[model samples]
Target: MRISELKKKGLESLKGKWGKAVSLMLLLFLINVILPYIVEVIGSGGFVQWFDQEGTPLWSDIFGTVLSIVLIPLTIATTWFYLDLVRKGNPEITEVFAIYKDGKTSLKLIGGSILQAIFIFLWSLLLIIPGIIKSIAYSQLFFLLRDHPQYTILEAITESRKRMNGLKWKYFLMNLSFIGWGFLCLFTVGIGLLWLIPYIGTTLAAFYDELIVLQEDEQPIEG
Candidate 1:
């Protein structure tokens, strides 16, 4: 589907669902923003020094790893929640925290994230363009992981690459359409992101839904 169509339908999906969406957004703040900010404050303000004379580097790595683990699944969970919101029109705000309830799934998410990061970094070492392309190629990893939880991380990564073949540029444009909204969020001093994040999430989910349907349609007819 085209970018305009995705935006129109995505807005329609979110029209009466702002409350739930914003709630999900706030949960995201706890996951993505507040936790890291608190970590940084503690590290920079000598809070960790009471325990150790030299803790800054250790604290940095600790928080960095913690945030990576938290962020990877939280991101997938956000997309999963929004995908549900698109498909069924509603999902519980607690859905965002569902990852914590399943330890195995959370581990797999962490593993997948580390693998993707390593691959992207290695590719980036070769050239910027290849890194960008690989990043987009793996863009569907989280969605597929959520939808097909039975799939291994490698399976999801492979399938995402296959599914995104020839469509990454279109997907990139769909994301580009949100640049204006993102900048507007900056003007509001990041408060606007409480709204814009979910807006983009729902729209991206809708776009994924469209891709699913398109893929199904292109499949060979059964006798």
Candidate 2:
């Protein structure tokens, strides 16, 4: 599907659902941003003290790394929630934590996220462009894992790479299409992000749906 169609589908799916979408975004911010900032402040005695202490920066980095790793499942679950919303139009708010309900799935998501990050980082060492390209190539890994629970981390990664082939530029452009909305969000002092994020997430889910259809059509016939 074209980017315009995907975006239209996303907007249609979000109709009558903006409140819930914005609420979910706020909850995510509480968990991913506010909670971390609070923890860092407490750890350093206060926000101002974070910069005053000599070794606090190192500890802050360590804490940030560990927190990000722990949050991998939540991150993927958020994606799944958006996918569900795009496809079904009424995903439960609890769906944002679905990965945690399955221990094995949570582990797979965490491991896959770590490995994906490492691969991207290694590619980044070569140059910024390759890293960006590879990141886009692996962009579908989490969605693939959500759809194919039986897939191993490496299998999902490999398949995402294959599926993204010849479509990286299109995907990149699809994301770039959001730049205008992103800039508009700046005028709201980031408050507009609650709406913009869900807009982007649902559009991405539509993109994935389109890719799946393309994949099915590309399959060779079995005579």
Candidate 3:
């Protein structure tokens, strides 16, 4: 629960398992590229058609709608994948996909993703600050779900809320702390940005695991 301890552990995990972290980032990038491109092609005018068209194509709009539907689940899978690496120190890039390979996990990711998306989107309407707060607030929901797959969605969400209490500011600062790394990456003309995403992501994942995950079977008892 100590932020300093979490930050230290995250740094250590990053130093020890950077290669796998990088691979995960690469996979995410590839997926980001492919899904949009694929969707564009499936659109009425085709991927390139939108560029020349006066207005957006019907297909493009449809693609956007469909993507909205799929994005949540993908987000969940990525969250779990990254956290697994952090928690176990065993970096398996495929763990994310492995979860999706099963129908139940896939559905769970989709459900959680959609719900979070809506929550985040609503929070954003209050102003940008609330949006960021919501992001950090819901950030650990995926990790909770990953660790306790048996729990209902509502249960996992409630746990995230509890753990995040009085610590949202701390989590936000931790997240903000990555901005320097991001800026450094940008200074390299985005060459470093590619690596930065994975590096920062794994580091954050490590931070969450160390600070929030319970290693013992029994809950900590009050004095």
Candidate 4:
């Protein structure tokens, strides 16, 4: 699908659902952003004190890192929620925490996320461009895992890399297409992200759906 069509599909899916979508995004912001900020403030005593110290408390930084790692499943859950919204048009808010209900799935998501991060970091050590390319290549890992329960974490990572072949530039362009909206959001003091986040998420889900169709079409027919 063309990037325009994918974005159009995302907007269509979001019709009559903007409120719910924004609410979900707000919940994520609370967990991923606000909660961490709160932890940092408490750990450092206050912004004034933190400035006097000249750096964040070591324990605060460590806690933030550990919290992010522990919340990896939440990221996958967000992907799942958007996929469901695009595919079924009625994604439940609870879907944001669905992965946590399945211990094994949660573990797999966390492990895959860590592995992908390490690989991207290693590539980044070589150069920024290679890191960006590798990050795009692994972008579909969560979606693949959601759709293919049988795939081990490594298998899903491998499949994401394989399927992204020849499509990295297109995917990069698709993300670049959001730059205009991003700048506009800055004008809103980031408030517009409540809507923009869901728009981007649904569009990504649409992109994954297109990839699945393309993959199916490429399969050789049995005699």
Instruction: Flag regions of model 4 displaced more than 4 Å.
Output: 43-54, 217-223
Please give, for residues 45-151, the per-residue lDDT of candidate 1 as tens digits: 65555355444467767877777776777777778888887786577777777778998898898899889889899999999999999999988788877777878
TM-score for each candidate, following the candidate numbering:
0.84, 0.89, 0.78, 0.89
Local accuracy of candidate 2 as per-residue lDDT tens digits, 85-132: 888758878877766888888888888988999999999999999999
The TM-score of candidate 4 is: 0.89
Candidate 4 contains a number of clashing pairs equal to: 0
**Model 1 segments more than 4 A misplaced:** 39-57, 216-223
Give the Cα lDDT of each candidate.
Answer: 0.79, 0.84, 0.68, 0.85
Cα error of candidate 4 at position 174, Å: 0.7
The window of 10 residues in a row where model 2 has the poorest summed lDDT is 214-223
Model 2 per-residue lDDT at 144: 83
The local lDDT score (0 to 100) that residue 148 gets in candidate 4 is: 77
Q: Which prediction has more favorable TM-score, 3 or 4?
A: 4
Deviation in angstroms for 42 in model 2? 3.1
